[model samples]
Target: MDLDDHGLTFSADAVMDETEELRNPFPSPPSHYTKYTTHNLDLLALYNERLPDRRNESQAQILADQTDVPDWPLTQLEKPRIDWILEEPEPYYDVFGERWFVKDKIPSLGEGGGTQLYPEDPTVDRRPALLGILRSLLVTYSQLTSAILAPPPSINLSPANTEPPKPEWEEKVEWITVLAQNLMAAANDLRPVQARGNLELMMQRQLQLRREETKALHDKCDILDAKLNELRAAAQLISSRGDSTDVAMSDPTPTKVVPDDVLAEDVLRWAEEVE
Candidate 1:
């Protein structure tokens, strides 16, 4: 048998020999070639046998009759609660034990610094409690780290032995360091710099307003000075006119009245007082 894209074929002589054998309907003694060929052909026959047969119109109608068969409705699963501890792999290993699901552990800083065990039983779900603890730890760490990283106090201190800070303190310190780095980066952002610049600009504007006010006051002073000078000039003119009137009214004699210098001094003093 020869296999090709067109299908299986046999030479005319081979077919004739096979036909004579088939007409006798007797099994031939198996040779190596026959055995191998038979095995391959058997596999092909089995493969074809396993394939689904093409549906005829009658078979299709039979299937159509079963189309109205009711399908079983799907059921929904109940959702688990928040506290339920879903199984998770152990985070750490023990010297002698098979790996198994375990409760989560968090390092604690207390009177006795050690790891705090949190129960992970599904019935006792303590995620919220654990989260609260973690939050508190974070806050404590922030404060401690800030203190540690803060610049030294202005006053000098004597060296002395001090109790070691908690592990949470160290964690806080690390957190603050990272926070400071982030803050520094954020400070470099254009928005913050622009805000600073805007504040400076506002200060500049205020200064300019002050300067303008000062200039305005100076201008007003100049106007006041001009008025003072005009008043003084008017006072001098009145004194000169009074002297002429006294001269015209006198009997061409030396009539002694208060000295003009004294009167002028009195007038100038009055002007100064008024100013």
Candidate 2:
């Protein structure tokens, strides 16, 4: 049987042509084609499925809905929040662990041998100020507390030294430390008062700025109104004058009646330039 006649055989030239046509031009796939082709396409399909429809809403709206927005994002937005924090701030000593205080380096006193007063008043004696006294007490209290808490020195001695030390010394030192801490707490408490005062001052300044801006806006509005009125009067004058032969003869050129919008635009531009 003839293989070609039975459709089971091909010519040698035809086979070569078919092989060349079907041959891969590249040894390996192109970078872009292979880049993510191996990655699971189902991941993207799943992500698209999970995403919310945002046809009616904008991407910004969608993201905003998803994200937490601060109540006071800007300083201007928090203008009226001075008395907002009604609850008295909890003392730092109460909030923080005593270990933090213990680990913290003791804050140094005023410069110049740590005895310099707040004011260098020549008339007043070189006595320590109230702040200085508090600072000194705090330092002394902390030192005493540290020393009291220290482990007793190692020694091989008499039975008298073997007794566990009494708690009386620790109790007294703790009391003194508490007093110093209270004094320091009071000093810290005064800072909020100053902050509140500063806030009030800022509020007043903001109010003043707003008032000035309002006044400027009102003045601009008045000027625009005056200009609009002038334009209207001019238009009326031109219309009335159109009926008169003498006026028509005196000026052959008819005055262009500027549109209200055009006149307003010019006025606004002038106002902006002046500002």
Candidate 3:
């Protein structure tokens, strides 16, 4: 079959065959395969361009020997086979527009029960060999996005069904009861002494008030005694005045040169006049 009829003009087998002929030593080298020919020289240039510089010097020397090329200043013939192994085809490019090319057999839906490509109809269920791969990639991407965007789950401390136990409050109440008992015991021990002290203070205050009241009453009695003495002196003065008046009235004109008989007659006259 003419390969061009199937839209495939370039054959990897033809290129490999030509390369083998150039490496063979039994026949004289073909003029078309010389280093100056456009085809051979183009292939050699591409090979040299693609050869990695980091290859070991020993490997480079072996490659130079295999191609019957000198090692003085590296040439295209000395380049490794790996340099040309993935040479780009002319017809197509990779997804990123890079010049890598590969040929693969994409299985149809019914071929060897392998994965299906370009599936038709909405209802037909066809299992794909790459389903697990796609599922894993989607799951990984979703997990990454969720980790970046979603809020963290809340951690609730409350009980799910019933109330949590109150051990802290119960412990506090127990402590309070113990403290109250201790306080009651201390109060009982010191009750009589405190009551005795309060009673003594009250008695001292009452004694002080009684002393003040007694002093005030004694002062009032002293004032009353002084007023009674003043009244007795006034009564004695009145009594003395009355006694002098009586003596003057009984001896009227007796001392004026009269005899005892005249004095008696004078007393009778004065007594009759006073009656």
Candidate 4:
């Protein structure tokens, strides 16, 4: 579908995205039904709006000078949310993470540490974050209700060993090693499953091929056996004719010769025996 047909052109969005200014340089966005439907309100209560010291002046004087607006303030959207989130946010840039162990390792820019990472106020170590997300998901999605249905808490079965605590760096290295080993073990476990499937497929294909070959050979043998039976019947018929002719030649009178009807009867008996 053409954009013109649907009245859904993206030229404005493309221009706004490329502009990258505090205010969009492109034409004002076309008004939509949402603009009319929204109930916008301004909730700004800045310190600058505070009345001059109440303790230093009389109540009447403060009342006379009061300029506070009542009820709903105004549309805060007029204040521009992008300016609040990203644009010209110089006053609060000094804030930093709780800990940045790799600060020095990060390559220096022209002025300061390389760059501020996204949501750059806290160091979220991978293990804790992952575990927190996992725990939250487990709690939120678990359908089991009864304690009897719940899995038993795991307990260590190995004998306790008294060993000195390792340094932080060594502990980090151990964590990394364990993570790598876990990944490798998972991969190894999956490898055998895939190999077993592939091997089974190949074996089944070969077995099917052998079965087809065996069936073909059996069919050919049946055909050859049928032909051999036919040849044996023909040979028996020719031998009967030869014997009858010999007997007729040995007879003293022509009357001793076998009649055509008797010969046909003998041939029919031989055919029945072959069947």
User: In candidate 3, what are the lDDT values of residues 78-140, reduced to their tens digit?
Assistant: 444544555745333332223443554332333445332323332454235135434544565
TM-score of 1: 0.24
For candidate 1, give the lDDT of residue 116: 31
Q: Write the per-residue lDDT of candidate 4 for residues 197-244, one digit (tens) a residue.
A: 999999999999999999999999999999999999999999999999
Which tens-of-lDDT digit does each residue in 207-267 have in candidate 1?
9999999999999999999999999999999999999998788767676676655777788
Between 2 and 4, whose TM-score is larger?
A: 2
TM-scores, all models, native as reference: 0.24, 0.30, 0.31, 0.26
Of the candidates numbered 2 and 4, which has the greater lDDT value? 2
Ranked by lDDT from best down, the candidates are 3, 2, 1, 4
Give the number of the best model, judged by lDDT.
3
Q: Pick the candidate with the highest TM-score.
A: 3
Ranking by TM-score: 3, 2, 4, 1
Candidate 4, after superposition: displacement of residue 82 in Å? 70
Candidate 1: list runs displaced more than 4 Å.
1-188, 253-275
Please tell me which model should have the higher lDDT, number 3 or number 4: 3
**Model 2 score (lDDT):** 0.53
Q: Residue 7 of candidate 2: its Cα lDDT?
A: 40
Each model's C-alpha lDDT? 0.53, 0.53, 0.55, 0.49
lDDT agreement of model 4 with the native? 0.49
- Deviation in angstroms for 205 in model 4? 1.2
